[model samples]
Target chain A: MDRVAVIGASMTKFGQRESWVMDLLAEAGEACLDDAGVAPDEVEHLYVSNMASGEFEGQTGIMNALAHDLDAMPAYSQRVDQTSSSGGAGIYAAWQSVASGASEMTLLVGGEKMTHQTTGEATDVIASITHPVEYKHGVTLPSFAGLTARHYLERYDAPRESLAKVAVKNHRNGLDNPHAQFRKEVDVETVMESPIVADPLRLYDFCPITDGSAALMFCPESVAEQYTDDYAVVTGVAGATDTQVVHEREDPTVMGGVVDSGEQAFEMAGLEPEDVDVAELHDMFTILEFLQMEGLGFAEPGRAWERVEAGETEMDGELPINTSGGLKSKGHPLGASGVAQGYEIYAQLVGEAGDRQVDADVGLACNVGGFGNCVITTIMEAAE
Target chain B: MDRVAVIGASMTKFGQRESWVMDLLAEAGEACLDDAGVAPDEVEHLYVSNMASGEFEGQTGIMNALAHDLDAMPAYSQRVDQTSSSGGAGIYAAWQSVASGASEMTLLVGGEKMTHQTTGEATDVIASITHPVEYKHGVTLPSFAGLTARHYLERYDAPRESLAKVAVKNHRNGLDNPHAQFRKEVDVETVMESPIVADPLRLYDFCPITDGSAALMFCPESVAEQYTDDYAVVTGVAGATDTQVVHEREDPTVMGGVVDSGEQAFEMAGLEPEDVDVAELHDMFTILEFLQMEGLGFAEPGRAWERVEAGETEMDGELPINTSGGLKSKGHPLGASGVAQGYEIYAQLVGEAGDRQVDADVGLACNVGGFGNCVITTIMEAAE
Candidate 1:
């Protein structure tokens, strides 16, 4: 099988923008093509990762619209939706398009337009992904995060201050990310004093409602030289699903989808978690950061909080994580968050991440959808 | 590249059903697994083709729910949405999963539950795919179909009755399909006399809104024998998009997507249209059948109407089309319509289409999304 290489990547400013989803997608897509020095005519396939353009904007067929917008006429296009992990799913689809020899050049753009709707409407649209029974009880994703955070804190006897550190670290990282939604740094005291939205999870502990888009260009490794000398090959990519009803899980702290997908990705890449020099884990909520760290085998089952407390996941730590501010400070634009994570890892691996650059040859990204109902893990290595 | 083979296929009764989208999907999925004698646990990738579960039922995360419902936990699942052609898109995704060596066995289930909603509501949701500019002028898919039909009839000097014959022939075929929505036959006079819907085209010229689901199982041809000796190999599959705004088309009757996708599919299959012994063409509107026939190279550019008038597309004709009834009679359940088209072609190729059996070794299915905004063409052959 042929390996897939990332030849280009781009992301729009991860904040509320004036452009609609289609415009945002085109912005990122055009920039990505420019970055890779590839013409729109050369793109064989175009995949859009978006969760709810229909519900959010009363618009559908955005993929076709995007194809027209990008002037990539007659190129095959499809919308990939896996809730919030849609971007990660798009990565897998792009890889398959190249690996299967169906496409020589595949372009993936993921975006979401949310700020136009009220917070209540946005939350309702997102809550639709939860189990009907759970949703009927008003159990949105933030509520799930709160419940899990309480459980972890009590079960592991972890200090609440550790959770606050996640927000602080991501915010600090955001200060260096020109595209982040929130660039101002916050301290542990500020996060701890913030009003609680979900019990034990303060407002600062959760990602904001954001609108943005991100894109990547993928092609077979054999043709990477035609694009650029510096590129990152996707060594491994895998996705998995867990029980949709979150409460059905035996352990609330562990995300089965994350564990399964992460293991598959690592095994496929022939690398372990410790070999990952840089990482990007979905930090939709502070508690999620800890859970993913443990689920991805970066920390023991319940000892991830200790690593955070010790600054082990800091930008200069042994395994720097979320160097792009992640969904926490970078903003969680449903579909675009996962692609932005990949963009960060690719930038880091290719040594193009200006001020936020991390020393890394191998990088990993984990994207979780619907409180870990589904997760995708991707491992990339700097081309040797 | 490994050849993709279809080992199993199933479709629920295409009509107004009490089942939710999830239940309908599970019905087809379980039946397909049973048909192949494969356990759910053995399924590695599950793709759901759905255009608007959220808009129709306010339900999201349907792919995850379906994975859990089918007890296919840990299987990778994603939703493929390309408006009405989502099922065909799902086929492309499933093919990539196997052809790319990402999954050993992939199950694709396409479904839509829209009968519960009012026709106006359903049409509005479907219309969302059209360009906002055109949609603002009240240009829905059916409207586009009417305009295209008017132009084709005038330009080709074709009789309006030729369009009526499409409904007549497909209705006659539906009589032999136990699961078809409308089993009763309708004559050309009945169709011609039906109430006008969008001018030249009448109510009968359009397919009915329906609730149903269909499933297909795909794996490598080398391993298909382990599951079934009567499997069919997907020799060719491809998709393409056209201008999202219908008015931007070079020719209203051309259907660029169909032409592009069909050309690609035939090239990949290493076969010409003459090799197709049986076929199913999207007949969301009577005129669409005519356009696809010509677009797929089955007939000369403007002579498809003449072929339909000559009975060359009947069940016992030279190239039997829609042996299981095209969407015109089988019921257009949005996403399921395309997969059902594949099911018909597969059954015919495998010689398992009982009463409607056609002596066919090769078959083709063409699925069109929106008003020719995007299209997928697939060609399959019975394994010797």
Candidate 2:
């Protein structure tokens, strides 16, 4: 089978922006095509990863509108939504489009416009993904994160400070990322002292509701050389689902979607955790970084916190993670977060990540949707 | 390359149903698996084609929720949306999943629940796909249909009776579809006398706001026989987009999306319009049927009305179109309409269309989204 290659990628500022979702999408899309030096008409397929344009902007069919805006008329376009993991799903969809000979060049753009609404309204829209059986009982996403964090700490004998450190570490990394929403560094003490949004989990523990967009241009590996010398090959990509009713999980700390998707991705790539030089894990919540770390086999179960405490995941450490600050400090614009993760990984693999560049030949990105309801894990390597 | 095959298909009663969107999706999904005798665990990928569960039901993550409901745990799942053409996009996604070797067995479910809301409320939700600039000018879809119908009639020198006959013919075809929403046949006299909706068009020219679901199961041809002896092979599938702004086209009478997508699909299939034994065209509005027929090259430009008037598209005529009532009488449940169109084509090719079955070895389905914004055309042949 032929491999899929990332010819180019683009990311907009991941923060409150004046643009509507369509404008943000077009911004990243235009930048990606320009970065790749590909004409809009060359794009054979276009996919937009957006969770809710109608709910957020009273707009639907943004994908079609985008094709029109980019002057890429007649290129097939559709929207791919997997809630917050939509960007990851877009990666897999674009990969399939190329691998299946459905399209020779595919453009994958993921975006969301949420900051315009009040925090409560944005949270409600995001909370709509929760199961009604659980949501009807007044369950919100943060509450689930808090309960899961509490369960993980008690069962594993980990300290709450470990979660706080995740925020501090990602924030420090964001200081070098110009596109991140929050570039200021924070210490563990400041994180611990933050106001409690959920018991034991503070305001700093959760990713902010953000508005942003990101784009990736994909094509078959065989023709990638004609486009650019700097490119990353998608060695492996997979997505999996878990039980929707979160309480039914036997192990609260274990995200089955992550583990299953990660394992599948690694098997497809013929690589293991040790082969991944750098990684980007969904850090929507500080604790989620730890869970994905363990789930993706970077560390043994319950030992991910130990790695975090040892600074093993920090820059210049044994294995760096979240070089783009992740959703923690980079901001989680729902759909864009996963695509942005891919952008960071692609940048690192292709030696385009400026100050954040590290010695890396391979990278991985794990995107989670709806409190681990579905997850897509992608493994990429610098094109030889 | 291994060809993709459809092993089984199912459709829920497409009418005003009491079930929620999730219930309707599960209904068709469960039946599709049962029909194919495939276990839920065997489905490697699950895709849900839905337009507005969030706006209509305040629900999200429906694709993940469906995987859990159908015990298709760990099966990769995502939502595919292209407004009303979502179901057709789902078919393409499912096909890509199998063709790209991403999944050995993929199941697609397309559904919507809209009848609970008043007609005005449902129309508002459906109108969200219209371009904002045009929508802001107090234009709804019906008005566009009216204007387009008037233009086509004047340009083609066709009688108003031609448009009314399309509705009467589809209503007759619906009488045989047990799962169709409308079974009562209507005559040209009654349709002509129906209350005027958009000047040249009347209430009968418009399909009702519907609630329904449909599903199709796809796998590589190598493994299709292991599941079912009766199957259909997807010879070709393609989608295309047109100007999002409806008025930008030089020829308002031509639906560029349908034309482009149809030409591409036929080229991919190595077939011509003459080879299509049956077809299911999007008839959201009566005039659309004429436009699609002409756009798809089934007739010369400005001549589809002539074909309809000649009874050439009847069940027993040269081309049997919309044997499953075509959306006009079967009901237009937005996302479900495209998938239902595929179901009808698959059934006809596999000789499982029951009373609505026609003598056919090849079939085609054309699905349009928004106001000719995006379109997908699929060609299927009976498996040998």
Candidate 3:
């Protein structure tokens, strides 16, 4: 396979925005193109990842909108929505196109605008993320996580406080992240006392619905050589899905896709968990962060919580995780989350992550779409 | 790249259905697995192509539902949606997974359930296939085709009777296509008298809204040897996108993606248009066939209609087109259209296309998503 590298990355502030989603995507795209130092025409192809523009803003064919908005006419564009991992899927798709020698340069942009809808309506729309059969039976995603949390507590004598530690850690990290949704620190007591969206999962444990977008530019290793020193090569990319209906799985705690995707990607990259310098696991809900850490081979079963509570995942600790605060604090804009994860890794690996930069050579990103149905794990290394 | 071959293929009848979309997918998958003589457990991964399940069935996590429906627990699955080319995209995704060593065998399924909504609602839903800004201003897929049709007539002086000729030829082809939606043949007068949905586009000139699914089980050539001998080798695959907004194009008659993707794929396969024995181009509207024929390098501008009218596109003619009735007669189930195209080629190349079988050595499938914003094209041959 031809070497694939991400040469440029950028994102709009991931919070409620007054600007339209189209404008935001264009801004991010422009930033990415500028950073990559490529002309608009040089972007031979495009992959736009936006989950619910039609529901969010009554807009459809979002790829064309982005293309028109950016005056990047004549470039081919396609919209991709794999739920939360849309951004990652877009990047992956672009990578394959270039790697296969179809196109040398491609642009991947992802964005979501939830602020257009009322919070309640947005919640209902987002609830569509769960399995229809299960969700219709009164199981929203929060409730699903709630069940997992309760089961974890029972199965392993897991401390309820450990969940709080995740929220607190992310919130503290968000304090230094200007682009984070909730840029303030929170205490364990504060998290514990927050309103309950689902039993055992407080409102604070859930990532906020956000309006944001992220953009990345990719090129073959040969083209990337024309740019600055190699800083981020997409060494591996793997996506997997499990049961959408939680009840169908014998053990809902077993996020099979997570582990399979991680293992596959790591094997392809010829690396182990210990070789990862930093990690950004999807933390749509606090429990998800814990589950994903285990899924990504960062910890053994039921040990992720202990690691978090032990400060091993802290910014200055042994293995910094979600230094940009993750989906929990960085904000979870459904379509943008996965791409944002890539953007974070790009920043960290390039030494461009201000205030929250991690001294890392290799970075990993894990983004999960609706439940565990779709999960994409990508490994990136500083360009050699 | 490692050779990729379709070990099994199946498609649900093209028409309205009472079963749920996931159920339809399972039905198709079962048929494919049974045909391949491989158990569900043998599938190393899954790539599902679904478009607008959220609007049609209010289901979001389609991949998960499909995995569970197949009773393939802990298997890797991911949903891929790229407008109308979703099925082709799914096939491409699966092809890449196996070719890149991500999996030994992958199941590619593309389906859509659009009849659940009222005609008006369905129109609104599918209108999303047009560019947002252009669509919002009353432009739709039919209208986009109407504009192209008008241009073709004005530029090439192609007789309107040629449109009727294509309809007649494909519907006649559909007579032998058991899975086709429209099996009845009509004369030029019948087509001329059909109701006009948009200027220059009559009802008979358009494909119907369909609810169906297509499934293909593919494996890398190495593992495919373990399956069967009568497989369809995916010799070439390429995808490209054009201007998202149709009106932004320099020439409405020119399909940039078709030209680029076809050229790329042909180059990769070391073949030319002349080498293609049969062609299945996306013909959502009558004139689209003409535009795509030229863009695909099968004929020069304004000459495809002459080719069609002269019987050059007949099953036994120089270059047969849409022997499975295409989107026009096989029905346009949005996501399933692309894969269904591939299914036809599989049948033809395997010498299973009963009455309409073209004794061809090589075949091609072209799929377009949302007014030519994204396009996927592939070349296939009898498995070695």
Question: How much does candidate 1 score in TM-score?
Answer: 0.99
Compared with the true structure, what per-residue lDDT tens digits does model 2 show for residues B105-153? 9999999999999988888888888889888996788888999999999
Task: Return the clash pairs for model 1, or none.
Answer: none
Compose the digit string of candidate 1's lDDT tens values, residues B15-119: 999999999999999999998888999999999999999999999999999999999999999999999999999999999999999999999999999999999
lDDT tens string, model 2, A153-257?
A: 988899999999899999999999999999999998999999999888999999998999999999998889898888999999999999999999889999999
| Candidate 1 lDDT for residue A25 | 95
Residue-level lDDT of model 3, residues B1-384, one tens digit each, is 668889888999988888778888888888888988888888877778887777777666677678778876456676677778889878777777777566687888889988878888988977876766676699888888888888888889989889888888888898888898888988889999999887787988998889999989888777778877788899888877677667768888888878878887898889999999999999898888998899999999779988988899987899999999988888988878888998999989988888888788899999987777778889999975
Q: Which docking category, incorrect, acceptable, medium or high, applies to candidate 1?
A: high
Error of 2 at A63 (Å): 0.7
- Docking class of predicted structure 2: high
Provide the TM-score of chain B versus the true chain B for each model in turn.
0.99, 0.99, 0.98
Stretch of 10 with least lDDT, candidate 1 chain B: B244-253
Worst 10 residues of 2 chain A by lDDT: A221-230
User: Each prediction's DockQ?
Assistant: 0.93, 0.93, 0.47
Candidate 3 chain B — worst ten consecutive residues by lDDT sum? B71-80
Tell me candidate 1's TM-score on chain B: 0.99
lDDT of 3 by residue, A1-384 (tens): 568889999988988899887888888899888988888878776778877776677666677567666666546566777777787777777776677555688889989988767888887777787876676788777888899999987897889999999989988988888888888889999999999888898988899889898888888887888887855899988877777666776776778779888998898899999999999988888899888999888999988988998999999988999999989888988888888999999999989999999889999999888777778899999986
